[model samples]
Target: MEQWLGSLIKSGKRVVAPVKHDDIVDFAVISSPAQVADDYVQTRLSAKQYVFPKAEVLFSYKKDGKDVTIDDVNTDEFPETVLWKLHPCDVAGLEPLGAIFNWDYKDSLYNARRAKTTLVTFACAASDEYCFCASVGGGPGNTDGSDVQVTMLPDGDALVELISDKGKALLTDDIKGETSSADGIDKEKFIAKVEKKFTVDEIIKKLEGSFSSPIWQEQSDRCLGCGACAYVCPTCACFDIQEDSHLHGGRRVRSWDSCGFSLFTLHTGGYNPRTTQSARWRQRVLHKFSYMPERLHVTGCTGCGRCSRACPVDMNLVEHLTEIASHE
Candidate 1:
């Protein structure tokens, strides 16, 4: 089946899958299924904006001083994109993005492109010290938001499970593989052995109780407020609105932003709502572990653990959550 799938994808049909680059794996246009990099434990880039880019132009505008004209950008230009070999958290992160992009204002630039893309995810058979998807309800080898889920058999063969029609289309007779029900697999056993060690409910509940906890200040003391954690996080969805202009015309653009920045909540009066790193860190934790749940039915974390890995001061989510969860 693997060989057949590779042949189908290689037929110049515009398929993209994860491929290894340097120390991390990233999704790219694959000429064949053999180019897919399921062996990589994690990806450097969160699978967030392959569908909704980090920055996009909503529309362009022109003004005759008294008259301002707004021209909505054409949505028909978005191309179909495919993503494969995603971890559990990266897959689930898309849902939270849907909440905000679809809130009061519908972002056509994002939703239009997202609609044209299909996501194919693979369960993580093994994870490093930084992974903790299991604690967030997505364990190693877990499939939450994927259209198709893949598993590597003990004999190094691959199993394909189509969770959605979009996923089934990725298959071809040339790939010659068997189908199985992934539903009954022993997910807990897989997580217990290799996935990160953490508890999702406990962290969420602890966050709910730690709104004013002094630990936020202490835990965030070493934070440089660089926003790297937010940038690398799979579920961080804050964005800033801006207008780009030339001499005669301009357009409104939205780019990914982070709450970790000192000026994220700044006002014109020079008052910053979250000036300190602790306050910013507190906001980050509360937003993902608490506030997001209130707004969306799902937790905002997919638990890829990149933030924990990327922190300059070594701010570990597992350590922070463990301490916070133990406060009770």
Candidate 2:
């Protein structure tokens, strides 16, 4: 794996992998294989930033004496990239993101970046209690959105399975290994070792009647309104746009925002729609399980469990969903 990564980096394609940054492990561009972390079950942030950045300058404008100029951010600089070592669930999380971006209108910037990247997924060797991939129509080895899926055998040899033409193009004749096929490899058996926490049908059914339930307030009263959950989520694509202007010129900037924050729904007037934490929390849950599935034909979450793990106040999504399921 290290040899393959080194070869990719040497070929001028940017390699982004889970690398250790102080106490947290997040996806970062790597110049060498040594920077990749081996100890983390999941990264602090998802690989979505490679396509959708945290903050991006959409366009810049300048004015001078009845003259104005508008410039778009250069799309030519988006590097040919490879996302390595992300889990299959993380790769699947991109599905909802892609749907929303391409829904009403096409975002050419996102499309350009996405077209140049290839995802290389590593099957889970183990799963923790926080993981609920199976409950959300994904599994440890499910290759829903991966270009290539690599499974490490018990003997430490990796079986690289190409799932797309882009994945096949990545491997050249110079890349050598013990070549084999995925003829008898039952990845589902490997995934079955992990226990499922809930059923998707049951949870969605329970949510059908939970629109006005007081359980939202009960669960969200303890929330600190930190917005950490959405920040770590791969499918949360809400963003806020702002214009920074000088005396004569300015630029429009787009930055990520979250429903968990109090200021998210604040209006210019002294009115707020989703005013309380309970309302915000309800939106978060419904957006993932209800609204997204109904409108976009895809669950807004991939069940990677990053939101639960990153929540400082110990908000457990699976526990709340299970509680909602048992209500009726």
> Which one is best on lDDT?
2
Q: Report the number of the highest-TM-score candidate.
A: 2
Candidate no. 1 TM-score: 0.87
Please list all clashing residue pairs in model 2, or write none if there are none: none
lDDT of 1 by residue, 1-328 (tens): 4565565465544566678877777767777666667556677778776765688888898888788888998887766666666666677788888886786788777688778777777667777888777677776666667887766667665666688887777676544345445665654443324544567677777777677789999898888888788877777878889989986789998888988888889998998877788888888888888887777666777778889888889999978877887887
TM-score each candidate. 0.87, 0.96
lDDT of 1 at 175: 46
Off by over 4 Å in 2: 176-178, 188-192
Score candidate 1 by lDDT: 0.74
Local accuracy of candidate 2 as per-residue lDDT tens digits, 1-328? 7778788889999999999988999999999989988756888888888888998889999999789999988888889999988899888888998998998989877888899999999888778888889888898888878999988876766778899999988786567554766688776555434567777787778899788999999999999998789989999999999989997889999888999999999999979998899999999999999999889999998888999999998899989988987886
Clashing pairs in 1: 1-175, 1-176, 1-177, 4-174, 4-175, 5-175, 89-302, 123-141, 124-141
